[model samples]
Target chain A: MPRLINRHPGRGPALMLGLVPFIVLIFAYLLGSHVRLAANPDDKLLPTPSTLMSTLHTYAAEEDVRSGQVLFWVDTMASLERILIALVLSASIGLAFGLAIGALPVVRAALAPFVAVVSMIPPLAILPILFIVLGLGEVAKIALMTLGIAPVIVRDLALRAAELPSEQLIKAQTLGASSWQLVTRVILPQMWPRLIDSLRLSMGCAWLFLIAAEAIASTEGLGYRIFLVRRYLAMDVILPYVAWITLLAFLMDWALKILRSRAFPWTDMSR
Target chain B: MARVTVKGLWKRYGDTVVLENINLDFADHEFVTIVGASGCGKTTFLRILLGMEQPSKGRLLIDGEPVSPEPGPDRGIVFQRYSLFPHLTVLGNLILGLELRRSRVLGKLFGARRREAIVRAESILEAVGLAGARDRYPAQLSGGMQQRLSIAQSVIGEPRILLLDEPFGALDPGITADMHKLILDLWAANAMTIFMVTHDLKEGFELGTRLLVFDKLRHDPQAPEAYGAKVTYDIPLRRLKNDRERQRLAIVEASGSEPSYAPAG
Candidate 1:
């Protein structure tokens, strides 16, 4: 008699039940678009300023839709490549220094106030300077994402390292564990279950920040496509791209969840 | 094998004395339980024995040599609350000491550390009746099983001396008794020295080889300037081999309750 989650008793129906809200959201959002169109036919359904202003249905059938789709696929690949590069760089930076700072209490205390001060300024505030310094190239995007994500990653890890049980750590020391071994055995293994959750959350934030950064400066990413679509008021073109990006972000989260479950299968999902 | 001897042990946190002139000895393979009411300095005494702290006026000797105020391979501690790592599997939790503490770089690279660690952990877990539950996480285990897992970890490290602070105090009576039996079985098998702090009277009687009830009010001359705790009694478990011992064990059991204190002279 599970009460909170399983309203349905069995698998087949339960799986179907999971899909109901998503199905309903699509139906509802699309229905609202129709109603909005019916109420104001003269009002633009979507933005398509690049080619020409047109109705939602009219632009839905144009080359803009096809062109947008092509742009989407290419830019998605580029964005993905950028994110992977950023992940490696940030993970390296985050882990190397994170472990160092996280492990040492003196280092953490000395740097904590400064770290907190810098975090509040918002990484997005210095985009123009980053653009000037690194140029509006893939390097800047990758660098920005690393800078943006690493601190958060390190901060999370540092706090976790701090939260590590004092007794076990004392026990490890009593057993003659080296510092490296402490990190490898006690820290990382324990860090993983949390690190996975942070990684998943960081993935979403990375996407959001990357898309924003790309939109402001990128000529060829999904953000550029969204910006390009906005010119001609093509709602249908813009809408699907939004839907795809949303769906992809969701999929990445779900996929990462699967990876987490596979990697550390022992942890029960924390609701 | 070290004969851990503490002499005129003095410890204090600021102005409050925790253990004063606490003289005690744990021979190789001796299982001594330090039982007292809470804040009775039993744990502080254990920590001092483990070398996590130094006695202000006393000396701690391992094999009759002074030990550093730091943890070493000779000591293994099992805390009641923080028994196992929440993220690691039972096997992973068990081998952490060996993998991280014993193995060298070559050991890690040759993959010997991992292999040997796993082997040791598996055998340890099996000894504690946790073979079927190797893949289970600490969070997935019941309190009793987790306690067993913790015991395996401490015991598997094969330290010269084991320090446990209220290891079964958190469990229900049924689980606690089961854990006590498991601990007894492990002790019987290994015959290594064990020093545990406990407040459970029945548990102290059930698990201890030698019972030392800390006298929180006993005056110590050397430690008067530092910490000021005293001992009530140190009873040999051999005396409690039968039901008659249980009757004599009344004083050992009663020490856990509030007793009127004489002002230190």
Candidate 2:
């Protein structure tokens, strides 16, 4: 009897295999776009690749008439800056909170339930409150992203810290580590890679909150530009912008993974 | 070197008692081994001695002064598992205590002192036969190597007393033999006062200058918590030089509910 052995593909084959689905989707889109355009050259719904490229060039390569700014670069920079700031703020808060709660029984008993409750409340529901307090500026947008992602990072880190062997804590204590020293030397040193992992896991949710906040109110951002183009049925600009945002997100995720593997190779169980 | 004295020690968790009326004196530079049946409060006793857990009633004294309620450099401990910090390499684990002692900030050992610590750590690693694995993480080492590194880590602190809670309980015979020799060498070389708990009776007899056996003699099913484990025997092995004495002690252990030691010949 013939049997099928579905072994995991190597890097080259895996990459080629990954592109198969995308190639199929593109081929289908191209055929459909061609048919629609053949019927009506004035169709604005499914813009051809050339139309999208030209629109992308105008936004990315050329300067705007009024502001003299490359809108694509400006939007990318604004969105990236907001995300970077939010991620840093949230990760720092999460790591500190998680370390305290996980290491200290009093802190855990006092704040664990409160943190759990806060995490349950969706961040988007409080978007209006954030705007009212912080105004409809970059602060509000970044705050929304931070609020959405920080709690999750906290939960993950706390759980990880709690799961560490009690022996490690005892060993550190026996070595004359004070409570502060124990947390800083033993707990925090071990937690750096896990913190990075928690941040990486929260990145997807961060992007979602970032886009939502920017879409609601922002002068210059990828999300704001996407919403702006949607008003005039500018699918050419909208699709490319969406693609560009996806690319940026994937790159960020890939870079973090590489950093984690390179810097804390011991954390990788597979190795 | 410091003498350890335990007077009227008792430990309880809620309604259930674990250790009851433990009183003993450990001389400086003595190698003491505690052996007992499973769930006989050996580990609980060791934990109390290490200051990781407090006794319900009684106090431990190091030399003439009372031991601190919390763990400190005066006493060090090695557990059967998870003794090494997984994040640190073999050399890093050995130097951690030195680094922490010198630096105010954690994980930031600096300048000439740091280099000195590393050099000392490397020598300790070589002594422990782990020089080749100095750069590897604990997870990268074999179980035997990991235990050796952990022993080095505890010894690096130069603690007056070293507590072991069945540190060789999980290793195979060959590795366990190597560990026993290594531990004995370290103890003699450093002049450390050592206290260890183990389930293996032969191991208890082989390595200990003094052996303490723990057991529960009374069992009341209706009042299960009525009796807790107590030190049944405090035999000084240094004086048991003849087969007659060993046979006498073994016979006494078999016949009586409490451990009895034979008089020194």
Candidate 3:
């Protein structure tokens, strides 16, 4: 038999092992829910799977009497729109600021310290300020998410750009590359995968900011729905909504990973 | 082809002097190899010639005109590593120089011009023995193949002068022999004046028509930065051809008693 340290599972066995924790957690939750429902038939803290499924069916299939639209789909769409817009805005701001600050010494001198300080400020602390300045609208929510993550992306990409080997830049210059050409031809191509990676990392923060802003002010969103239903002890609705959000986040992260590998195959070998 | 002339060149970073009072002249199509100890400013000299660096005092002239402070396509360089852009395939790396030279804004070409660039790139890739790997990224290549692509990337522009900074220092000894042959063939075919800085004295002597040795003449124990290196021995090896014993003696004498040549930075 192999020693414990040396013993390693094959790919098939390793994937099987990865599912063990999820299976155990689900089994434990089902047992707890059964016990709770047996003790109190009207218990709402841990709803049985049937109750949860029925609630999901009602929210997803039935339109609200007044809204004339399905609340579940409406909430998901509103949340997706806000997060996607915020992500695009943050990525553009990050890429443009990061490359300028990293590639040009003058830009670094002028803005690096300011960016450093900005990144240090707690983004959530200024929620009220943002709401007041940008008003209680979609702009405020998007601004909150963008402000939360753009500085981090800028700092990460700046470090990456600055860490690029000086030899490559010199070689580009010797090939008749001007300043703009150097950035566009040499530095910019290498930063795309890294930018994707930064976006992947910032996804969680973006969702947090999105939910916080929506919980505070929005009329419709996944976060708003969850928060609105919390007063009634609606575990049946909240639990499924939380799971759905997690699945959506997982799919997004997985998509980005696939995009990175397919678009920038060279980065895999670099690691 | 380019004639390079250096007159009283000095490079000092504040209080620390890196190179002091260097003077040399090179005719067109000459292959000069520079060997020195670590931190002796051989790479700095090459950078100056390539116009990536400017001398603190004195002038570097090419064909009787002062070389521009900014690096230009007139000169090409291949470092030991990180010379090829990793994001680009081998052919993409070769075509980039031409595209950058031709199209200033987009740094890209189209139609017939793009086809012409590809043809030029393919031919150079063929010359460098990388025709099979033209579609592969630099990271996918072996060390020796990457170095070949680097050399190809530099030479594709057909610059008048080629600067090599220890281009083979990272390769295996067995692989370096093949590289030496490739570089010699490229040098002869391109007819560009070349200045190569190498840590290996034997490789320098074997490759260069002219050999330069950079060493410091004076040193102060209290202040190590008080002095800088100069070209101590400038030997024309073409005259010493067919004399193996003389070449061996010259290598021994140039290295001196300690011969502790560190890798060039």
Please identify model 1 stretches exceeding 4 Å from their true place.
A1-32, A35-42, A46-69, A269-271, B86-88, B106-126, B175-178, B188-191, B218-228, B239-265
Give the least accurate 10-residue stretch of model 2 chain A, judged by summed lDDT: A1-10
lDDT (tens digit, per residue) of candidate 1 on A98-182: 6767887778888767766765657788777789999989888887787788888778777878888788778777666766667
Note the residue pairs that clash in candidate 2: none
List runs of model 2 lying over 4 Å from the truth: A1-6, A38-40, A269-271, B105-107, B240-265
Error of 2 at A115 (Å): 2.2
Which candidate leads in TM-score? 3
All candidates: CA RMSD in angstroms? Answer: 7.9, 7.3, 5.3
DockQ values per model: 0.31, 0.34, 0.52
State candidate 1's DockQ. 0.31
Worst 10 residues of 1 chain A by lDDT: A46-55
Model 3: residues with Cα > 4 Å off, grouped in runs: A1-5, B242-265
Each candidate's clash count: 16, 0, 0
Error of 3 at A149 (Å): 1.1
Better of 2 and 3 by lDDT: 3
lDDT of 1 by residue, B1-265 (tens): 7688888878878877777787788777788888887777888888888887778787988888888778877787888877577767787777766665556441132376578678767877776778888886777676677778877887777788888889887876645545655676777688578898998876676677788888666556756535455778888885655664455447445545322222121
